[model samples]
Target chain A: MEERIEISILLDFYGELLTDKQKNIMKMYYNEDLSLAEIAELNNISRQAIHDLIKRCYKQLLAYEEKLNLMKKSFEQKKIKNEILEELHKLNHQSEAVIDEQRIKKIEQLVKTAM
Target chain B: MEERIEISILLDFYGELLTDKQKNIMKMYYNEDLSLAEIAELNNISRQAIHDLIKRCYKQLLAYEEKLNLMKKSFEQKKIKNEILEELHKLNHQSEAVIDEQRIKKIEQLVKTAM
Candidate 1:
């Protein structure tokens, strides 16, 4: 339970910031729970460099998560966007007059592009 | 102009993820353009440690930035929020029928809280 909880929080925190390579490495090591040597062999990096990069990346990633607070801020932004979208959807349904479908579409475009 | 251009880019990039301490150091060094020894004396850290920390921090910050693309993503998110807010503002004003002032207010609250 504790492990699951920790992992969820960490994934929620640093998941977005991870490079594809880093993410793959983390998935292998943490999720698939592969050993460092095995991961290094698979990735074709020296085991020592893998160890150093992973350790350093992990530390920096945690620090970035802490300093950036991206996850919390991003979650809040999404919640707001969803709420506004919901309200707008209701409004679009209510009006007998033509909703500015173009404008609404543009707004949706903006939201989608950003997210 | 070139100098300004670079600072703007760098600040826009790493401006959010830096520690308050790191931010201060950066501002002092880059903006005020102080030497490391001056910064060290002011912050009361050893020159060597300051040098090491700053060098390491700069590398890590640049890597975090390159890998995460935080600046680009965050700017896009803000632009979307602003567009949505503009659209919502237009709606609030256009409605002759009872605008859900409370709902609008709540949405505004959400945007304000997030941004």
Candidate 2:
């Protein structure tokens, strides 16, 4: 489960760096949870070839992440954003009487739009 | 100025999609503001070839944007995030008496970390 999440995040950052064929194969294998034999039959390739291709794609994705660090930066940014949102929520709940309601609503709207 | 900003945003989204040579050429032309002849001399290529390569890279970057819209989405998200931050700053100032000071500081910290 953890590995799947990691791959999905990597794919989000570097999927466009892959060829069309590799992209489709990765989508099938990772997103659709298709087995190697199924992907092979769908693409009219040998099972071993499908396996190799998936392995190559995974390696490439990891290599791209290593060099670019986009995924790492994105994850850190998301964590911070979530933390800010949590603080806002707490403020809204605790200071409902004293805080301006309209301003709180506007902040909520902006956060929702950003999400 | 606007064109340079657009190119930089597009490059951020799709630069890794380019080959190493193409990426270097693009950085020289767009980011470094190098003329075609200057880039050509730096890379040991003809001036016309350098121009053509930069054009090709621009086209590819735009094509990637058209297909993916990652840069557009990113820009919109940033705008919304900025709006939220503005609202938070306003809240911090206006509600200084009622709102929890620590929470405001925490939100500011998170936003700064995210940025």
Candidate 3:
């Protein structure tokens, strides 16, 4: 599960850097949860070839992350967003009548926009 | 000024994909405000070669932005952050007695973290 999450995060940040074939294979194997044999059959390649391609894609994604740190920055942004939301929630509770409705709505908008 | 801003945004998003030489040339030309002749002399290359390298780097940066839209997303995030800050300021004004101190600090923290 942790590995899947990590791959999804990397794919989100660097998938465009990959070739179309590598992107498709990664989406199938990781996002669609397809087995290597299934992807190999679908793409008319050997299972071992599919395995190697996936490994190469993983290495490329990791290399991009290491160099750019986009995934790390994105995760930090998310953490800050959550912290802001929590603070907003506290403010909402402090003054429910005066600050809840519009402030909460704006906070929701900010969260959605950030995401 | 607008062109410089655009290039800076593009550089922030895709500069990591460039070669070290390309990166150095771009930084000297755009960020450091160096002339082509100056850069060429400093690097022991022809002025025409420096110009060509700068153009190639610009093309690669644009291609990356076209493929990934990371720069666009980043701008949108900044706009959202501004909107959130404005909303927080409004909230702060509405309830200075109750919400100003901690909420303002938290909002400042969020803005800095997001940046």
Candidate 4:
């Protein structure tokens, strides 16, 4: 995966555990695509401090992932989603199927529960 | 929920993030059903300090739950499991069903992923 995308996901999964300052800096760097110097200027801090803070934030997020593994479970959930769709596709093509909307809604609930 | 049971669940969810000492103390208190005085004597701490540590550990665990909500999500997954089983029950009773072994395997996978 791309670096920024991976970081963004870590932030999404563990962002609530972070301090607000860490979150703001992470969004500016990853989401807004700001330069380290620009983020430093915006926050009235030294560029080196911004760089270190970004590293510290990423480290903290990665540590949380290590303990909880919600991100990895999420990927597993994605695989399950695909498998469900594949089964549905098989049902559609292989027979005169009546996969009811209610079941579909329940399957959707299963997928939604992953996040 | 019962107090000890709830704390045990919290420890299960966030225990990995705690120190080894914290985990040991929590297991002794909750899992082993040890009293505060007994735990303190075992660990060579004052009863009051043991009491404080238990409260601190719970606060920390609850704070983690507040941020991550993995415990709540686990309960939701459990609810989903029941719904899936109920649907399966309905299907089993409503017809001479030909639910394939492969599909049952996949459903089993869904339930196992919650853990």
Candidate 5:
């Protein structure tokens, strides 16, 4: 799961950097689960071209992930933020704390704006 | 970030369930960033067909994600497991307790076998 998140972060950051053909090849093979021959026939390209595109896409994805470490840091920051939000929600729900519905609504509005 | 992970797992699981045409349409549009007319021309299909297929694909993807919630639970479980492993590694690093390198090696082997 950790690896998946890390991979995803790298994917998102470098996604714009990917060529249309390379991205299409990855989507066809990994996301769509299409066979190489199927992708080749569909796109009117050679099977070897599809194969090579996929390989290059994977290599680029890994390289960006390894060099930037963008995803891991982003995930950690998100995790912490979520934890703090949950605690805030919990506090709002507690009966002992002078429950202020108006304040809660205001806080929710602020959160929405920030998001 | 969380949404991306959730979307990814749902994408993976629902990806296996998508029809070839629907999946291909999604790939050409979202991942490939191709215009509808371009996809239609390339696939030798009508533009309307491509548009309809993409709409249906989005509907199915959302339905699968909402119903399954597979990604959310999986993410939580992974988070817990990783925290435990990190703690284990930290303990292994500290010499405060009688460190058993042999036991650690044995545990690593067991973990590999389990994986």
Candidate 6:
């Protein structure tokens, strides 16, 4: 993934663990693509302070990812969903020609609930 | 749920995060139904120490559940699976004579994955 997407993913998963001020700084810098000086000026902090805070937040987010691995589990689940979809397609296209709309819908709903 | 079952459920969801000794003590007490005295004797620790450690471990497990809610989620998922099964039963028994074995198995697999 791109660095920008990776940071946002980490933030999406664990940003609540950050303080409001720290989280705001991170959103501005990472999500908003603001320069350190721009963020520092907006928050009334030194550019160096903003730089250091972002550095800390980046490390903290990585640490949370390392410990929790919720991000990894999410990707694994997507893979499982794809695999299930393939199985459903095969089941529908089998030689028996037993494919029906109601059945497919019910099966799709079940897959929706599980994944 | 019974107290014993609840503890085991919490332990099952969050036990890996506990220290090996803490987890072992928990399993012995909750799953094995061992008294504090027996556990203390086994670990060569005082009964009071064992009691305190168990108290701490219980609090820690509850904290993990509070943060993660994985135990709560598992129960909720079980309920959803039951609901899906009910829907599936209705769909199978509906006007169409579509209660086939291969289709049912494939639909079951989808429910298995999502839940």
lDDT of 1 at A59: 73
Candidate that scores best on lDDT: 4
Candidate 5 Cα errors over 4 Å, as ranges: A1-9, A99-115, B1-115
Error of 5 at B45 (Å): 57
Question: Per-residue lDDT tens digits of candidate 2, residues B27-115?
Answer: 88888898888899989999999889888889888887776677776666677567556756567567345775565665556455434
**Residue B31 error, candidate 2, Å:** 3.1
Query: Under the 3 Å rule for N, CA and C atoms, how many clashes does model 3 have?
Result: 0
Q: For each model in turn, which proportion of the native inter-chain contacts is also found?
A: 0.24, 0.22, 0.12, 0.24, 0.00, 0.04
Q: What is the C-alpha RMSD of each candidate to the true structure, in Å?
A: 8.3, 6.4, 6.0, 6.1, 17.1, 5.8
lDDT of 2: 0.75
- Model 2 - which docking category? acceptable
Best candidate according to TM-score: 4
Stretches > 4 Å off in candidate 4: A96-115, B96-115
Q: What is the TM-score of chain B alone in each candidate?
A: 0.50, 0.76, 0.77, 0.79, 0.66, 0.80
lDDT of 3 by residue, A5-108 (tens): 79977998889989999999999998999999999999999999999999999999998988889878777667757765675656646743354545556565
Return the TM-score for each candidate structure: 0.52, 0.71, 0.78, 0.80, 0.39, 0.63
Candidate 6: which stretches are off by over 4 Å?
A2-4, A10-68, A82-115, B93-95, B98-115
Stretches of candidate 1 off by over 4 Å are: A1-23, A31-60, A94-115, B1-22, B30-61, B93-115
Stretches > 4 Å off in candidate 3: A95-115, B95-115
- Count of backbone collisions in candidate 2: 0
What is each predicted model's overall lDDT from 0 to 1? 0.64, 0.75, 0.77, 0.78, 0.59, 0.75
Worst 10 residues of 2 chain B by lDDT: B106-115
lDDT of 1 at A81: 65
- What tens-digit string does per-residue lDDT give for candidate 6 at B1-115? 8878898988887776678899999999999999999999999999999899889989988887776676786677666566555655654566655445554564556456544
Instruction: Score chain A of each prediction against the true chain A by TM-score and list the results.
Output: 0.50, 0.77, 0.77, 0.79, 0.69, 0.77
| Model 4 per-residue lDDT tens digits across residues B22-102 | 999998998999999999999999999999989999999999999889889889877766755555445444454443445
User: What is the C-alpha DockQ of each candidate?
Assistant: 0.18, 0.24, 0.21, 0.22, 0.02, 0.15
Q: Ten residues in a row with the worst lDDT in model 4 chain A?
A: A91-100
Off by over 4 Å in 2: A16-20, A95-115, B16-21, B93-115
lDDT, candidate 6, A43-97, per-residue tens: 9999999999999999998887776676886777666556555555655566765
| Interface C-alpha RMSD after superposing true interface residues, each candidate, one decimal | 8.6, 7.4, 7.8, 8.3, 17.5, 6.7
